[model samples]
Target: MSDASTNAGAGNGAAQTPVQPKMNILAQFIRDMSFENVLAQKGAKGETKPDIQVQVNLDARKRQTEGQYEVVMKLHITNKSKDSGDTLFLLELDYAGIFQVENIPDEQLHPFLLIECPRMLFPFARRIVADVTRDGGFPPLNLETIDFIALYRAELQRRQQAQAAAPATGQA
Candidate 1:
């Protein structure tokens, strides 16, 4: 084939190929972590299981580098003695991951960042929580599987409610 025809054919083939969506986990790290035994020695004496409250929050922001974003998943756990209501332990963890995303449309990016990125980080964060609690003279805290989609939906609903209430409160 002549050089001109070959080049034209190659260009057409490249143009016809679809760009697949891609997500790459560049790095994962514990940005911050804290474990506190509120009662110290007194916290571990009880045989009863503690009432544990776990709260999860997530945030994502674009980085200066193209196609790169940072997602942070924060977990707050507070455990209290069931019988006496004394505080047992307070655990806080901020786990973050750097991701490179390409070819994903803007409409889908928000859900991907809020749900999928944090979902990827949760298992490691859960293991850390369990290990810290077990090493702190308590039973391992086995966190339940989180539903990221549900969390994302709830967050959206909450923000909508807040926005709705803001206008009503302003009128009063």
Candidate 2:
């Protein structure tokens, strides 16, 4: 057989072969959730008190992928007294979902999963945090809408800037 034909056959051989695999949401579960409304009761008592501050940080991680991916949404929330600057409470919640992705092109896969999927999950995760806080006894913590796409772009720019500013390594 000619070399060109032999190479073409080898390449086509893998294309015709079918691999057995399944794409399914094996489980969509909350890995962890922590809630603390330290001043909820204090505030609910209807007494005039010091001002309180609420801060939130959202994070995510992807676990080992066999056919599907387990994506986690981690929330770091804190409450503090604005006047005295004392920490009232701190809570970290990690919620996760098992997403099945198959037959998705590589170019579109990242934006779909990273941007779209996370956006879909954010509200649910936000609700859990807000409800937990309100039930804990303080004022309901209504988290502001986050723009993940903008945040991602800014983060990428920052990294590029940092890399560009760093001195190149070479022997003197």
Candidate 3:
């Protein structure tokens, strides 16, 4: 084969990248969300003053086959009233997005799938969390923005440090 033909053949696959599936928002629903105010009535009456505290956590997982992925974002929330010592609320939401990934190099794909994709879906997830909390009868929760890339890097560092600290096992 001529050099030009050889080059053309080699470039065909690269040029005709696999057409990834379009991200489908098949389902966007709150998996689990709960609210409990132990002293709500008492606090409302001002009989018992309560200090409010809020805590949040984020988690995600990816499942891929061939050239498709299901990315899930789990948001866990807790709200408490201090003075009245009452449990205000607890919410857990699992929001997911179906993504199509194809023809991307491995190095770039990791970050894109792990960080960028989730970041894109976070706002919708946040809205769900806020709506659930508000509909449950409390003030709407405006969650702070999250840096998924930073989180991924921190998690990567943690894993690396853990591996380094672990005693080497004989079995490789």
Which model scores highest in TM-score? 1
Best model number under lDDT: 1
Quantify all predictions' global Cα lDDT against the true fold.
0.92, 0.63, 0.66
Candidate 1 collision pairs = none
> Candidate 3's residue-wise lDDT over 57-108, tens digit each?
3443455456666666776676655665566666677767767666667677
Q: Which ten residues in a row have the lowest lDDT in candidate 2?
A: 52-61
lDDT of 1 by residue, 2-85 (tens): 999999999999998988989999999999999998767563553766899999999999999999999999999999888888
- Runs in model 1 deviating more than 4 A are 1-18, 41-44
Task: Find the 10 residues in a row with the least total lDDT in model 3.
Answer: 48-57
Of candidates 2 and 1, the better by lDDT: 1
Residue 36 lDDT, candidate 3, scale 0-100: 59
Give the residue spans of candidate 2 off by over 4 A: 1-26, 37-67, 165-172
Question: Would you list the rank order by TM-score, best first?
Answer: 1, 3, 2
